[model samples]
Target: MVRASAGRIWSVSSNPCQDQIHYAQLNWDEDGQPLSSVFGDVYFSRVNGLEETRHVFLQHNQLAQRWEALPEKVHFVIAETGFGSGLNFLAAWELWLTTAPRSAQLHFVSVEKFPLDKNDLIRALALWPELEFLSQQLIDAYPCIVGEGFHRLSFMDGRIKLTLIINDAARGFSKLLTTTDPLYSQYSAKVDAWFLDGFAPSKNPQMWSEDLFSCIHQLSNAGTSAATFSAAAIVKKGLKFAGFAIEKVTGFGRKREMLKAIMPNNSQDYFYPQPAYKSASTFPSSWSINTNLDIYPDKHALIIGAGLAGCSSARALAERGWKVTLLERNNAIASEASGNPQGVLYAKLSYKEEAQAEFNLTSLQFAQSFYSSHWANIGKKTGVLQLAHCDSEQVLQTQLQEKFAAADELVQFVSCTKASEIAGVPLSFNAIYFPNAGWINPAKLCEQLVSHPLINVVTGIAAFNIQRTEHGWCINNDRELQAPVVIIANARDAQHFEQTQHLPIKSIRGQVTYLPATIASKEIKTVICSEGYIAPASAGIHCTGATFNLKEESKELRVEDHQTNLENLREPLQELLAEWENSDKHSLDGRVAFRCTLPDYLPAVGPVADEPAMLHSFASLRKNARAFIQDTGKYLPGLYLNIGHGSRGLAYTPLCAEILAAHINNEPQPIARDLVNALNPARFLIRDLIKNKR
Candidate 1:
């Protein structure tokens, strides 16, 4: 949905050459209504409605005294003309989880036409159970599309992002990406608060005409405020002829006057700039774009471990130009199990349709876009749920909810009363939820993924020393250097390199059983999962551990691994731990480490070659390996490895660092190069040089 053409600025009546472009395109009429307009005894809704909208637009748009006087993480962005049944987005997500504050961020935006149906939004959000779990995460992200629509429900990930604009608020505020100036703009950030509630002016008079206040005064910018439950008189003469200053207020809960206005500060010098993003200046701070310029346009790289997968792959390859030195024999950086404090985006969903259900659905959508803005710097969103244990994992969560209907925010399945209202507990099992999943903090996302800018981490410097050199591979992480490429992302201390100790790696030795928080585990705020996994309290305990063992590899620390993580959290919160073993205030805070794996558990990743030149370069198909061939260097040339992402390193380490930087930037590898040579580490010396020539 990325098309628009009213007075074309970016025309496209139709073109589905999509691979990625969904800015949610739209257009609907023929009785699907939504031409919209209204003012003078309020009415609005050319579709959008959540109760003649919160006492006519957020109680006279003062929004709880403009969020108890702003200042912290400042963000407000609310503009609207319609976005039906989102009940003003579940009443501004229950007023930003009850009265903003806590580093604010909202960005609402609206405008829509003919869009509803997911059982007419589950019969109009079954009369809002007081926004019960955000109206069941907007009925599990509405959008079924029988026709016209534009959607973007990011709820609670960037702290509520919304952005629907289905079409026509005078062509979606003239294709926003604003720079401000349309009509003495400035409600705050060029167009802050202004729902204006459309639907009247005589059943939609081209939405209060005069070209809708000349497209909101050419996309405004000048101390704006424009409100309207409607105080008639040609809608205050089209908002005082689109420059704003009108005021009338007093209509909410009992209508008796309401117009509120103010656009003063009109030193209108027209401005709107803000969206050029592409700066990480060898990475250090500020980022929103330059996401390592299309992800590290290689200026140089060679990361290979400083722990936490070489300090998060040397800050995702020196924020994309790879100068990282990390290496490490252990001097600090998450001394393993990524120095846990929290780590549960655990997506193991395959209640039927499998391929590890598209590899745990593209590693939980790149771990929710790599931990979407770090759960407010450490962790929170508190929703992972999962539950269901028997009856074949409740019919594999209904065949992974129809094979992840294009990732309906990671996954759904609920009911044990909407999974006890999103895992607040009280379940008869059966759950799935994953509403953008949560529980992060892994040493503050591994020190914010190796705080970038061509990283040089160093640590206990342990490469020891290597050879092969004509211009690459010199080695000596303790001092010497040179490279063509090198990466191991150490874990199970990469089998002390005798050419990676015949890697078919195995280590397990885990242990987690923390439990402090009470009052029924502090009302469980999501992230529960069955057989193992508990988290939701984080850094204040609650972390219900891991206990794999593989015959123990000890870094010390156990109690039979906290009785195998309280017997795997007694299978799905066993009746919410019926006062968990007669509470003496349950204890045990396990963690042991050693987890690297493989035995077809995938992720060994490319080029660390020359084990009998990949056993005679795949010796006529490992006696049984001819699937397809042509890659004849069988690479060992400059060495590489990302490690068998066993216990799904937070769902496969940033998608195996975008598949080992797209096989070191030859690009295109999103899966398939024979699943990237089935995670190549030279398929066990091409199956022992094709079983000694058969």
Candidate 2:
């Protein structure tokens, strides 16, 4: 196990010097079997890997029988220690489709130190033709595998979701066990099954350590089943130490014995005593608390606001078989910031892997895949080019290029000539090119998201006077509407409600200039960015500009803002600007909207905390900020928030919606615990209390 301190067993560096992912090295034998070059072990049985996986993982965990017995609209979670070639996940998915109810969802979370390259994965899975359909889908949606964090991919119309973590097994699982605030560790979702599939303990002892078993125990509850192909003494001893009841089982092929275990239904029947070090005053002991609020038995939700945040949240919940009531104050949906003609899909990554940089990169990737799969008809995958217009920007671009050297497919530096060739226009400076990045019509995308049968979109009705009721919450508007769950996604207006009044969100006005596409301007094939961005022509017009004004409140277009947009393009696209300025046929027109943002620039997602209750609960921090308080912050039950996306609503909303839905459904989170805490709705309150302002 990797220890950063005396008590902490899983210590991940917040800012590691090297963040590039290292893919698994493999050697193919004459019989077309993959052997791990690092561990000198075969990835699967030489004799039928498919049957081996079905017998060892699926049958042993009783997944097929359990899936058949699952109730409608329920979800089952299965976590794996190592994801070598994704065979186990594919097998589980195949069985789920055949046995599980259509309304049921399957979530698979896997950790891998060294994931297989795309080509290697394809080659390995090709041996089984029966799984070609599902294998192809997995291959197509697979991430670039360049960074060490959670990469969530959805399949089968969001019925099957995968949270792929590219990190060490122990460290990655530890991320799910605890949040940034160690006291909140009890909030993690417990796994229903565990697949301990990796190299043998003799060849790879690190993967079978006590630390990993402890994480497994922490992420499990009564009746959690575990299966593995190893029957070594260390494996048995570790599982027993972690309170699992183990039994020897028949091996798959050439192996003599395997192990199958489950957590006893009663805690008193556990074999080993709880570790003393875990309960020490200096250690984190909140995991012993049972703080999980009951998931609303009825899968129905009411969401306020119909913008990108609201629409995305509705779609996410609807996909999981929930009936959603989407309320919009305006006469139509996407009439505010989401009504933009075009929005760019790209991330501004920093040199280090901090919260802002990491969240942006992760969200951008998820948004690209989401739009491509769901709204491909209205979106364009024409790529984006970020020009290095100044010395500081050039230096930053260079540093980013070096930082992501191993991920050339995600982002790469291109010469001016090469960039021009790619963009189909003349360029003066070098740029960073994101091949998967492009532009999407946010209004159309929102329409597509809310078109689901399970989501009822109600317009022209403003929700106010939200009050807690005996059954759930009620919004007293023109007509009273009540539901067991509620999500506030009205951007800056989210704070208008009494429960969320303490949120410190501000509105900044931004205006986008619409320039009719000229013959010369139509030649621009890709979205180009410097201080401002100009997208390729769509419907004979190019959407550009977006001047950021903090104090402006008027929604009318300003001539000065239009001039500023043109001037902002001078440094990056001087040649194109010169051609456009001389043309009298083009008229300067634009649209103005307000962007809701926070002081830290990160969106507020997940469950909303009760302001008055939290202030009273954590008030002890005012006296001593470092005190180890046992009391967790108080939260308003069944209340959630998905707002403050600012100008990047198109990029941030999809993943934030998934995170919120996961918390609501009581499933595994799609991101790390630290990132989850970063986007917590009560973060500002915690900060104020720490500073003695509350």
lDDT (Cα atoms) of all candidates against the true structure: 0.59, 0.83
Q: Which candidate leads in lDDT? A: 2
Candidate 1, residue 676: how far the Cα is off, in Å: 43
**lDDT for each residue of candidate 2 in 503-591, tens digit (9 for 90 to 100):** 99899999999888878889999999989999999999999978999967898788888888888998877877876666542367889
Query: Mind giving the per-residue lDDT tens digits that candidate 1 earns over 25-78?
Result: 223334332221212222233334445466667766667677777655445667
**TM-score of every model?**
0.30, 0.94
Candidate 2 accuracy as lDDT: 0.83
Error of 2 at 680 (Å): 0.2
What's every prediction's RMSD, in angstroms?
23.3, 4.7
